[model samples]
Target: MYKELFIHRLVQSKEPNTLPKLLEGLFEVFADFQGITTESVSSTLIDLTFLEEIRKLSGNINIAFGKTLRDIKCTVNDSDFRKHEIYLRYDSVKKLRIVSVDLPSSSLNKQTYNTIEDVITAFLKQISNLQSYFNELENIDHHCVVMEPIKPLYKDDYRNIRIDDKTWLHLEVTPDGSATNVHLIGQSEIWQDKLQKGLLTWDQDKNIVENIYTIFDIKNQSVSPTLIPVDAARKQSSEDTIGPTCGICYCAQLPDYPGLPQPLCQNMNCDVYFHKNCLFQWLVACEGGRPPAFGVINGSCPTCLQPISCSDKDC
Candidate 1:
């Protein structure tokens, strides 16, 4: 039953120009399978890591308003070719409402579906579980957990979580049934001050901690950590010392401080540390005397042109 329905859909969707070639390939694989599953339905495949998907969708795709269209994509699940996971996408811009809902095979009843419409109906039901990536955490009543630690049992569960247009959180699980701590750019020593200047730029008065909690929808009433101590991280500069200076105001950066909002150069090779307000002023100045709308800047590093949201080597 599966093979018959599967081949019918394939023949219908193939380009008329290549019917002969498509049929040739289909015959070669036909004998290898006792049955076919939903994965055999569509050719569209996306191998995007959870983070890559978030970054790609973050600011690049504008979903605020547009004509709405939706599509469902079935990808070859890494675990099994005989099984597939369905992603129901509702376009918010050219296209963007994306969510992951783990639906079991039994829910789709692939073993007994009599028609293609039955297959589509199961995929469409995923709409009820869709989670928006564009809405603010507080608005959705969910916390934006910046790299929440993943337990062993839940290791496979963490999706690449995004906090804003620039912030990307990485969740790593360990063999010891533990997970890595949440480490943001400037706060981590990975970039090591070649100069990650003013990169992780937050607007007006928003600090990393505040932004993470507010962005991730971390409940204001609940306490969850948002920072991890990176090895050899540069600290608030001492005014008496002449080590690192702010690129914007030329003021010395404070060293060895906790929860400070001083901006780092983010260039990874420049020795510039900045006060949050100073960077804010510099960003505003770059925008040609125009104040940032809604306290957000089109912030990219002046030297590297990289997203100025974190000082990590990767960013």
Candidate 2:
């Protein structure tokens, strides 16, 4: 009975809805077979209808189907038996889909299958990476200290000393009652000098002494040797650049230390600079009030639009 109804639907319908109707008819036939009402079968088969659509869409097309479906290809034929290609692809979010049909190779051809395929592929890869990143971040403990300042040693010249942007100096207590100094940038002359001068002392036994010194400095001299946490320190380093004061805003202060507002770009690799907040407003005005995304803004220098690459020369 199901087969009879399926054939009838297939013969009557002019489009792909035939598959759905046939599946619906099958539920009715099965209901009769099991002595159940057709109305009950219709209500119970709703979810199955969706599954059937997925199966049918995935079967006839050369597509990849998993939790996400993609890369659907279909063949079309002309009246004269000439064949053409129709391609459909799922979007990056997997919420939208795009379809494209091949055009004849001509000078006026406005679209190409390769271009569509490339766009679909790129979007998928981007969304996939974003999903993976968020998933990984879910496991991260954001409450832990993200940044710490390395202690400056006596023999260390403060000129060439800069904090590394990527490397985190984690303080760990070792088994030998000493602080283990695991050099991340490897053996450097600056590091060696600092280690010898007792600036970068990781000795757990000396923690009390260091604490005393820090407290004394804070109490007596009004100087806190530790500038910022590891994360803030890195952020400050990235924000600081040798530049001129902004002509319009006159905010010329470079990010010499943490807890200070970052300056805006003065010019392309030139001196003029503004506060980050000021620059953001400037950009919004320049772009007619619709600023680009934060990721794009962070990715490039405001002055040059070149990619920002932070380096660790000193700290």
Candidate 3:
């Protein structure tokens, strides 16, 4: 019965509603298929992800089957490639075109494929070759000996490279092998002030692996040994400190710390304090939370509804 319906729909493929209606009817039976599900992201685009291993491949895959083959777009799962996405489009009945195959870690030897499966397999093979590159990152982590280990963000090219217990370097290596969009994550005032004053700088022309060493050295050398740590500077009790309690936690000091919260709402009238980590979590869970850029998260202050920001790094 399903086969007959699908064949009839194909016969009337010129009808705008035919495919959707056919898919809708198929969902009644196919929705129960193990490991496969469909989602309509738009009138012409549908996304599907394999929940469990299917043919030894599993992750998010978006398939946009438009009226013509030229409009069809199939993006492979990019969990491993970071920002280097692999897009497959049906350019002809006998062949597929792979877009952006010039990824640094990917081999761009072939740009055309005879079949969708062939293109997917080729990309996956290229991505698998990046294991060595990932191992190189692990080696850098070992050499840096950061207080907190480095972490790779999900579906992102940036790495949160910890400089110390408080300071972090949010780094991204562009596809062309240049280090760009380097940002510092630390005490909001200290880092922002230094950035504005030009104390910290990044040279994008340099290689990312090489720049890591330079940036780490520059930041460390710029700091004074005689200066006291922020937590150490606070010799007073919570009651003695003149700071607003955390809007979310309602605590004067973050857990296990003697000093008051490090983050504050920007509003002059609503002087609220918040632990950096706490604020980040709250913002992420809140309704108007903006997505994370590098390591910084933007959201409104809970108390005054004023714009506020926080870093995800642990101090």
Q: What is the TM-score of each candidate against the true structure?
A: 0.23, 0.19, 0.34
In model 3, state the lDDT of residue 256: 63
CA lDDT, every prediction?
0.36, 0.35, 0.49
Q: Comparing 2 and 3 by lDDT, which wins?
A: 3
In angstroms, the error of model 1 at 261 is: 7.6
Best by lDDT: 3
> What's the lDDT for candidate 3?
0.49
Clashing residue pairs, backbone N/CA/C < 3 A, model 3: none
Off by over 4 Å in 1: 1-181, 187-243, 253-263, 302-305, 309-315
Q: What lDDT score is found at residue 62 in candidate 2?
A: 34
What lDDT would candidate 1 get against the real structure?
A: 0.36
lDDT of 1 at 197: 34
TM-score, cand. 1 vs. native: 0.23
Select the stronger candidate by lDDT from 1 and 2. Answer: 1
| lDDT (tens digit, per residue) of candidate 2 on 76-170 | 33333434344555332222233544331211123333333343344333333333222222212132222222232211111111222222222
Q: What tens-digit string does per-residue lDDT give for candidate 1 at 192-242?
A: 221133234323354333444444444432332433222111121122235
